[model samples]
Target: MNNFYKNYKGIIWLLTGILCGSVAGLALGKKIEVLKPIGDIFLNLLFTAVIPLVFFAISSAIAGLEPGKKLSRIMGVMCLVFLGTVIVAACLTMIAVWLFPVHEQLTGAILTEKVNPQPIGNQITALFTTGEFYELLSRKSMLAMIIFSVIIGFAALRSGEKGTAFTRFLHGGNEVFKQVFIIIMKLGPVGLGAYFAYQVGVFGPQLFGAYARSLGLYYATGAFYFVVIFSVYAFIAGGVKGMQKFWRNNIIPSATAVGTCSSIATIPANMDAAKKIGIPDVIANVTIPLGGTLHKDGSSISSIIKMAVVFALFGKSFNSADVVLLALAMTVLVSVVEGGIPNGGYVGELLFIAAYGFPPEALPPAMIIGTLVDPMATLLNSTGDTVAAMMIARFTEGKGWMENGEYGLESGVTE
Candidate 1:
């Protein structure tokens, strides 16, 4: 019995969640609103851990980078891989939106008067009146946190003996947060179940038709983005044989990510696969963790597509400049600036929505549809990470840090 439970824990939890979600949906149909609060509590539990967890994880990761000029190359390669993928993803999503448009006006679309949540008054007050406001915005802020962490970490490296202890402390903190992440992941099934249940309950069957249409388009666009972007990368990096081998080795991580729909939760499995594919320890260690935090191809692409669709459905046409800005902003904000945690999705999506000036009623529908389409997003994300790792591995060959045959264990590297 213990062995069975151990072997089937994830499946069991998933099935349990589906059952709970179904029940919650039915209850909502019957007009039982109490379940909504239960769902909120579950969601709150997920959200509460995000800020601290992201700060610790990213700060430690950046701080721990070997302090030297080599760090620049590492950051450069990472940024290129990230930005390149984002551009490709954005383009593909745009193509998909143009090809298979899914625009349906939502009946009863709740429209609230537009109010600027970020007022000049609040901004000034936050800057001066609150001592920790800057800290909160800087340290806990996703993009700000990454920048601050990298700067402080680099400073520590430059400080010689003076910064050694602090750097070590940060490293220790990173490890602790990793362990905490593992514990949180163990609760994933429960949290996901509650989240799904709440979604179904709150939205009810009335939302089914609209969401189903939107979500289907979302997933379709995501799949197209993955195939187009990753396939090209695979061809350039490894040719047909290399691409085949790469996919063979990474199938597990991709599947797991798709099934779980949480890139952060899939880190352990992704790292394990990276090792098997012969990705250098340093590269994998740096890339996968950083990728989980910042490499959000699926999420970013989906956001663009969803935004385009939403605008069209509302009879709003964005100029080319608007599209360009939205694409660039979504790519940077979603991929690089977002946190690498479970509920990081919510924060990232909200940030994008706000930055794009999307409506509030759109938030709920977007959240629901986005969550439903998460598995597809995760698959693309994991696949993109694997492809980037492979590309970096190929580029780093001949450099003393990495040898040619290292990542070609299964299928030897071809010229």
Candidate 2:
């Protein structure tokens, strides 16, 4: 018990802070809005660190690798696995909305801002490259940042002896930023607690009342996917034993994901969980970091919900075959499109509105529903990365991977 607490105390405190903040918000209402900056401070710290953190993490992982089929195979398998799970997520949500259906009367004033939607080609170009190197320093250009890191990593690896120092530099940088993130996260409880309070205090009524019915559908559906569907993935990864190992190590990551509401922020926790679960560092390092950028089952599920709800709100039938197929396709396309955008939440909303030709008024409720669903959506997106790692390890290392002394359950890690 003491050991469990030692391993998990960070997340415990963070969740407690969120709960307390939520209660305070419910009790104090608008008065608690004053605490918003505290939460913003925490978020800003994370956002500031993320760009460099990702660069080092991915680059160091790649630099440490040798030219082998395993790494390339892992990438191939990871892409396929991510795609498969995302589709499953979208399909499950599709069935749920179809069965119960989401019917919402848009009560809030629609967003009146002028939106000049960009062309898809331009969006994709912007997603992958920046006009200047300085632009990659920003978190908005995460995918571009990742691409550059990979190039540097491979360059370092190919340099043979000369690149060794740079490889060490990448590794040293990775460790430094990780420790920095740990320090920032120590403030998680108070920061997230205050943030939660501000959100509920300021927008709770709109989120809880006006959007409640639709929110309920998403929350309920996300819960099902997070709990039931993910468990099946774990079981498939290692059978019954895989499920036990996964659930046992997943608590901190799961809680952290919900608290942070950012997959990138949750990477460290997921990395630790991957360690205790005995995934090869090669697999964990690549999957968790890459997953934050490339993979998002939660967001995929939300894409379906957003499409359906928007169609329903506009008094259109979303039950047609073509529309459902389009929703699935759009979810995958926008998932890639928004990954590089800063504050990725809004990018997808705008992209979908533009792609489907939804009127500007449709943007408001889509934004609200998307915003409210973010916590769970992030939870799924972040924790699912760790589970995906397990599956990847199983494929790459065989079913006996866990028992091969990589996973020292008593000591957490053999290393």
Candidate 3:
């Protein structure tokens, strides 16, 4: 059993779990609902590491970098690529939703739940404002934590030797968190297996048939973006040959994301792909992790799709301001802390609710959207991370990176 578990791959286990869960769900129906707690435990375990993982991973990466104009340039390019693609994704989602509009009505158990509006100002303030330390632990204020980490990183960079010690401490802590995350992820197949079963039992197979049109449209759009948008990015970064190289190098990361349904889990593969595609270690190390935590084009797009489709289902139209707000929130706000898990998309769903006064009824459909779209979304997100790293390497490292010439990883080095 020890050898078996050791040899067992995570994706295989997850797929096996899904198949078993689906079978159990069909066999037992709602009778197996009692096992949901087990699935919840799995989800909770995955989320448990998220805050610390993000904080340490990003802060330490920033702190380790030598502060200078080159660092600034890379950061600028990375942010631009991440944000630009996310906005494009949101627009594409809106277009897809418009083309394949959903006309779903609230029925069955979905009609029973309603979401009340919360105080939006305080929640919004929590995003950019810093105060109590306790706020760092609150998942709702993840942006605040990210901002705080950035400050710490810069401060440490300026602190000289003292900062080095602190940064090292953070790096050590990050390793610890990574190990914990791996341990928790090992249980994912079992946990998510039960989750799949519960979802299938609760929703039934007809759920897919019911939402087929909208779901089909969402997937087709995903394919379009992956093939077209990524190709454009690759061409711009490394030209035609570069685009071919990127797709050829990216298969592992893409497969890992689709299988695990988590961009975070694809970090190792992303870094390797980046290396194969000639991105420097400095850029890959910093951007890949940071991208995993922040650059969420995939999730942003899915959120837009959900908002547009759900509104259309209820026979409503979003005004111009609402559209602007949706685009900004999904592109800028939710991207910062979008996790790489099954329900990670829920974070954006809340943003939709808060931003647009979407009712709780929005959640049921939103969840269905997540189930259908998350795998492709993760693939997009992970692939985008690699593309950003490549672009940044090209822009910051210039000829060496673009020409696929050999370059040593030197800190604060300039030609």
**Which candidate has the top score in lDDT?**
2
Tell me which residue pairs clash in candidate 1: 294-335
Once fitted onto the true fold, the runs of candidate 2 whose alpha carbons sit more than 4 angstroms away are: 1-70, 104-210, 405-415
Superior by TM-score: candidate 1 or candidate 3: 3
lDDT digits (tens) for residues 1-415 of candidate 3: 5633443355456667767887998899998798778887866665456678667866776788765545565677788878888888887777776666554422322323343434657546755665899878655555677788788878878898967789899888767876776777677667767876776687677544445666777788889988998898888778887898899998899888876667778999998898788887778877999899788877777777677656654445643564556456655666664553223465555545544545434444565566556678888888889987877777777655755434534655432
Give the per-residue lDDT digits (tens) of candidate 1, residues 149-203. 5676677767768877987887787667656655664655555555556545554
Every model's TM-score: 0.65, 0.60, 0.66
Give the deviation of candidate 3 from the true structure as CA RMSD. 6.1
What are the runs in model 1 whose C-alpha is more than 4 Å off?
Answer: 1-49, 69-75, 98-105, 111-150, 168-204, 238-294, 305-327, 337-343, 353-371, 393-415
Worst 10 residues of 3 by lDDT: 105-114
lDDT of 3: 0.69
2 or 3, greater by TM-score? 3
Q: Is candidate 1 or candidate 2 better by TM-score?
A: 1
For candidate 1, give the lDDT of residue 310. 54
| Model 2 deviation from the true structure expressed as Cα RMSD, one decimal place | 8.9
Ranking by TM-score: 3, 1, 2
